[model samples]
Target: PFTLRDKGMKHMVGKNWRDLFDLVIVQAGKPNFFTDRRKPFRKLDEKGSLQWDKINQLEKGKIYKEGNLFDFLRLTGWRGSKVLYFGDHLYSDLADLMLRHGWRTGAIVPELETEIRIINTEQYMHSLTWQQALTGLLERMQMYQDAESKQVLLEWMKERQEIRSLTKNLFNPQFGSIFRTFHNPTYFSRRLVRFSDIYMASISCLLNYDVNFTFYPRRTPLQHEAPLWMDQLCTGCMKTPFLEEMVHIR
Candidate 1:
């Protein structure tokens, strides 16, 4: 019942990924295994035949299939509530683990490059100015509330709309950022908020940091974080995420 996605699991990335695992479960039926009733855990032979007698008996160096989560926890002397799983899928990997096992999760996203590059550059500053200017015009309309002011508001609105359109298209012709759809976020990013604790462009980014050190996300104003003071990214810009200001938002 082993699903061979590539040239066997051992040959994947020079054994670095799989070498760290104390137990290897192949074709464990994943999301269904987490959602549905428990299944029998059986050991697989080299020819891919199951040993009926080896059911529920796990060893460090052995390969297993069709395993139950309960069997895994029992053998490891652990609980489902005490696990943190890293995965690449939203529904299949992160969602199932969060809903069923209550595991903390992290997502790997490589598609963030095109969007991040545009946001990090000076061209993004031009975009910011247009946004702030539009905000200021709206504020003036609210304060004045006269017939002459309304005429002025109409003129400014048309000019600002064109600038907003230009700024958005500066990043991409089709979609600006996969994480956002104008003011509201895209469905892909919404899933990240509900399930993932943190996301990174790649797992290799962790190698540069100390494993023993702790990471505390900086307090961004109006982002559910209350701190002593606010650091201004711009005179009138929306509060930026700490990492976004550093141009390394993962």
Candidate 2:
């Protein structure tokens, strides 16, 4: 049960938060909340008191505690896509409801704000741009057999590694980002997409969209399917210092 006591929510939607939802259940004990069916729902007093009675019918304006998903669905008749559950924790809050019960889940990843902010910076963009150029150069590394050419290729390899470490440290000093490991998506990121139907920096992002707004997933191409920039990127590699060094080797 999210109360509109959060100033962000208060400012975003000018209405009683309770009025926005058919029901609000707090201390849901999720994972277990979705799994176990024994714990009955209890009412919470307006003044933060707990009523231990095992009640059945749910009402608005009154907050409830405990409660399992089985009883919750049976009580509310809110099932499948009609129920969009927002949770900060991927596994504990969203996974079960999405995987087992078929409820649409929205993941709240606050760290996305910081990650995007870093990615938009000039330094990060420069490093990433150069890294792509270096990859194309590396593909030509095996062609040159001369000592000078081999030494230059080694230097490029070292520079690429340093750039990777620098960009990774820009996001986090130790673990880097939860969403990425170098150029690839991390395990956490894979699980995030699997569990959450939609995700954003904050739940308040919904304020920008209409109630009927539909979201579409981006269609990313597979490795065998050439990206539109592949030819241009490889052609751009000819302008790099490595290409000039290769010309000198000849």
Candidate 3:
């Protein structure tokens, strides 16, 4: 599921585009592209610059505009999970393709590149380390009802809140990362998981692997199944579960 804009693409328009896929559709407005069956298909000129007459049949080496999915399936006989569609817009481009048509969806999340870079920074790692320490101290505070211990717990809680804000600000000063808001997944992240079979920074990432390569989704640890930070600390692994979660997100 590669985009036309990928610079590293081996097959491109006016190059080896014919060898790339069985059919190519441009300006096929979607989710309507999949939902609307009555929209007539139009032809694109040889240079792929201007629209021509209405087309009844699809042909290789030729470009088309605003084609319906009904005719596309009937003509090409491509349907279900075999058809892997790639798009940037989650709802507009991919939701209907996956949910309605049963096509495997690949989401092009360009923000992934920047988010990964920020996650790898020393500042982000340091904040996570301190946050884990504060969490452990706060858990122990429940056993202490003394005034002095309560005062110390309050101070630690304030510091923990500051660390949380700082960690969020590392990715963004406003909304934070699209994948997360603090430790929880953002609304966008939830939708991304629902709509897409897989996601990457760019469609060009497909070049890094073989065509037949199978990508298996990792089984995320449930809340009840998650090991405590104290257990991980005793095992000498200071890394947070969120770090491991991030690796599996893509």
Candidate 4:
């Protein structure tokens, strides 16, 4: 749940780092941390000093470094299937944790703010820019004016480019986001969909909702799954049933 993603990054808050967990492992070099033969746990001496000796077993509120996921679970008395890990990198954090460790995982993407704003403000702006012109073009196309249709189509493409650029610049003016490529998924996004079990804007995103809530994805019928010409289906509400696992923090 904590990491040193960058030098200045904050690792934890509102609690003593060592006191929060039965053990804390650092520099394990994940996703290798989960796969590699992990180094043993290091404990603090009675006088609040580092003890270089590595040992097995739980000494509550002690810190450790370079230990494997399975060993940590053994100390905590949980099997691999009972563990949950959260991370940010699509491949390094979420995918590798689930695939290698057999641990349930959550993805934390901090750039969702940019994507959300583009969906809201830029989408509205794009529609406003084209409404009158596209309406006129539709009328002209119906009249079979091939030459006018070609010119109007050019205008439509130009309008689309402007809005697309505007939104892309907000995330990365030079390269845009790894998750988006125009109207299609970027290559990173293609891989992301196959791996992540769940995703959110940030780690804090869950704090706003039921912590134990089990997420249920939309069960919409695809074109091939539904009767031809039905065109659409209601996927139903997003909430899960009887979320007894949900926790409330005071």
Best by TM-score: 2
- What is the Cα-based lDDT of residue 77 in candidate 3? 83
Candidate 2 residue-wise lDDT, 110-224, digit = tens = 9999999999998997887777667778776659989998998899799989999998999999989889999799999999999998999997889999989999876565655
Per-model lDDT: 0.67, 0.80, 0.77, 0.59
Return the candidate ranking by lDDT, descending. 2, 3, 1, 4
Q: Please provide, for model 1 over 29-135, each residue's C-alpha lDDT reduced to its tens digit, 9 standing for 90 to 100.
A: 88776655568778877566777875645777666887767667667765455566777788888887777677777788877666677777776766665565555
Best by lDDT: 2
Tens-place lDDT digits, model 4, residues 121-151: 7554454334333333444444555887678
Runs with alpha carbons beyond 4 Å of true place in candidate 2: 1-15, 44-56, 228-250
All candidates: CA RMSD (Å) = 6.2, 4.9, 6.7, 10.8
**Candidate 4 to native Cα RMSD, angstroms:** 10.8
Q: Would you estimate the TM-scores of all the predictions? A: 0.72, 0.79, 0.78, 0.65
- Prediction-by-prediction clash tally: 0, 0, 0, 1
The local distance difference test score of model 2 is 0.80
Cα lDDT for residue 27, model 1? 82
| Ranking, TM-score, top scorer first | 2, 3, 1, 4
- Model 3 whole-model lDDT (C-alpha atoms): 0.77
